[model samples]
Target: MANRTTRIDPAMIDRLADMAYLDRNPAAVRKRVEGMEHLLERLFVIPGINRPVGLDVILDLIPVVGGTVGAALGAWMAWEARNVGMSKFQMTRMMGNVGLDFLLGLIPFVGAVPDFFFRSNTRNLRIIRKHLDKHHPSTVVIEQ
Candidate 1:
């Protein structure tokens, strides 16, 4: 076989750097957490009733594993919040929201029902947004 040269893709490296930035930067972290919250709490709206629904509710519908998965995702949001220098009191409140969501979600068929109203992910997102807006005012993005 002839000698071949392997070139590293600059675009791929940029993407990787962007992903890493999301974890450490306040602005990037805000977008990352907002995206997750949207996915978990408001991915779409149900027809007729016009109510929104998301993966959180769908996951809760499954037996034990679903709640665990949802809780894990919520915990991850809290972790990201900490990475942005969020206060301990705020983190505790965020975790409490996740914990309560997980506990309510453990109730088999009925568990999913609470998710529609509880919206823990949305609640947590609000906390993160408030913190970011107050401390990192430059990172704030005005919602249209």
Candidate 2:
């Protein structure tokens, strides 16, 4: 019987490192933010909408714990952004969207309606992506 060598791909290793450190170190942060940015735009950025709504809007439709669940989702995503080397300013902007969604969500039916349209996660994701672009300016950033 021949034994096969188990090898981890460098990209996987880098991804793990990136996640572990939350992209705090500049290079790692920049790379991970690229992902967050792409995800946000894809999920939320509607053509001609000017402002894209986010997934939290969907969450708000649920009964009692919906808003909390939505906020947690946004927070987890944002938490990764924090690790990915986002500046305090950028992080603040990201958190602001989540905060808005959470607060608006607390209201009754009216709030739920808006939540569907707000798309906070997508907005914050863009903020992270833009920051990375502004600071990092990589030539390879064209969307695949």
Candidate 3:
């Protein structure tokens, strides 16, 4: 058996530490979370209509390109999760959510309906927030 040595990047650790500091700030954390919510709303939740439909549904109607764009956006969310220092398990789960959403979205007309209801971005955001809450409690503020 051979022993392998791994090198850690100090700069990367410093960057993550800075992000952790930002996460600890309640206002900053709230702003970030709110921004994510707004994005999900724009993508998944339709306005002025009681039905559950949004840009993701409308865009996916365009066939290949639309679904691809949506999937790319979902992948960006997963990448953001990684930037926030989420565990590999958590990141993998986030990626799975996006992957499933993308695959299901490729199914012709029926795909649009699922895209509207699945809300993968929102789901991933929830997972990110949960991870922050558990591992970085300082980021969450409990109002009395």
Q: Pick the candidate with the highest lDDT.
A: 1
Per-residue accuracy of model 3 over 88-142 as CA lDDT, tens digit each: 9988888888788778888877888787778787788789788778877877767
Better of 2 and 3 by lDDT: 3
Query: TM-score of every model?
Result: 0.86, 0.60, 0.67
Query: Over all chains combined, what TM-score does candidate 3 have?
Result: 0.67
The top-ranked prediction according to TM-score is: 1
Looking at model 3, residue 37 earns an lDDT score of 46
lDDT of candidates 1 onward, in order: 0.94, 0.67, 0.72
Candidate 1 regions exceeding 4 Å error are 1-22
Q: Model 1 over residues 1-144: C-alpha lDDT tens digits?
A: 999999999999999998887779998898889999999999999999999999999999998999999999999999999999998999999999999999999999799998899999999999999999899999988779
- Order of candidates by TM-score, top first? 1, 3, 2
Off by over 4 Å in 3: 1-34, 42-52, 141-144
Candidate 2: misplaced stretches above 4 Å?
1-55
Cα lDDT tens digits, model 2, 20-127, are 764365456556644544443344655786655444554566654778887777776688776656778877878888889888887755677776667677687677
User: Looking at candidate 2, what is the lDDT of residue 51?
Assistant: 58
Candidate 3: residue 32 Cα off by (Å): 4.1
- On a 0 to 100 scale, what is the lDDT of residue 82 in model 2? 69
